[model samples]
Target: MVVYAISIYCSITNDDSNLLVHEYMPNGSLWDRLHTYKKAEMDWNVQYKIAMGAAKGLEYLHHGCDRPVIHQDVKSSNILLDEEMKPKIAEFGLAKIMQTNKVTNSSHVIAGTYS
Candidate 1:
């Protein structure tokens, strides 16, 4: 099995030239905007679409992929926004793969910080 996965930015390419590189978002994260702005303006329709997009993306990772994906950590700060305000989930360094038969959400693995 593949031991670990790296950040999208650092994943190596040996012979594949079809790698896709997404641009660094310029609008910062949703958390930052929420904290800095007094009255934010996210319309209901826009919010619905964002929620749907996030759900679909997460669903794709967890179910659509050959191996199940567990987003070890998910929070508002992890969600980034582009200039057009599209939410993009980032920081998959701690993400783990779940086998089809093995038990999930249970392990001897330690997460986050040193104790």
Candidate 2:
């Protein structure tokens, strides 16, 4: 499992807030590498590693964990890269923990951006 630096939940002025801290990813997101960053040319091996890491992370979330976590918004931007270009899944704001035995899950409104 990818270890996060720290997570804190606190209340300030009657308002609740949550914070999650992680190591700085110098390489930024995969989206930035592919679309925004100039001179960003990821080799085939690096790309393969990132793909495998992402797959393992998703596997852990879906089948390895006690409760299946569904990442509602999965996009290139959500895949963060460490200094070594290792991929780590981020941005779980739209994530959902489904009941293990539940056959189906439903939502009233759609979440996430279309484009």
Candidate 3:
């Protein structure tokens, strides 16, 4: 799940207006494919692979990083598929960077999708 951040642009007139660019994923998201097509459309092996990949990504974020990053919005829709059908976690807008020595962080507000 390598992200190549090409560039960032911001409007001088509007501080709120900003844009970020990254590499494109051809296969879209796992949620889209699962919802758009029948379960039979995707073989069991492929499904298992996707699931494992997502789990590994989450594992790395939680345990592998120098500073643990909590992906606050982990869901089917946020799991993107690359051209090879490999799972890539996306959407870190709600991610929380926890202290290295702390196992958890207290938050006043709740975030992420219910579904």
Best by TM-score: 3
> Runs in model 2 with CA error above 4 Å?
1-17, 105-110
Instruction: Please report how far candidate 3 places residue 104 from its true position, in Å.
Output: 3.2
Please give, for residues 28-47, the per-residue lDDT of candidate 1 as tens digits: 65567567762166777666
Ten contiguous residues with the weakest lDDT in model 1? 1-10
| Clashing pairs counted in every model | 0, 0, 0
The digit string of per-residue lDDT tens for model 3 on 13-99 reads 356664445457778888888888545567988898888888888888888778987888888888888777788787776888888
Please give the distance, in angstroms, between residue 101's alpha carbon in candidate 3 and its true position after superposition. 1.8
Report the C-alpha lDDT of model 2 over 17-52, residue by residue, as the tens digit. 666655567888878888865325787898898888
Model 3 regions more than 4 Å off: 1-14, 38-40, 105-109
TM-score of each model, in listed order = 0.63, 0.73, 0.77
Q: Least lDDT summed over 10 consecutive residues: which range in candidate 2?
A: 3-12
Residue 59's lDDT within candidate 1 is 74
lDDT, candidates in the order shown: 0.61, 0.72, 0.73
Q: Which ten residues in a row have the lowest lDDT in candidate 3?
A: 3-12
**Cα RMSD to the true fold for all candidates:** 7.5, 3.9, 4.2
**How would the candidate models be sorted by TM-score, starting from the highest?**
3, 2, 1
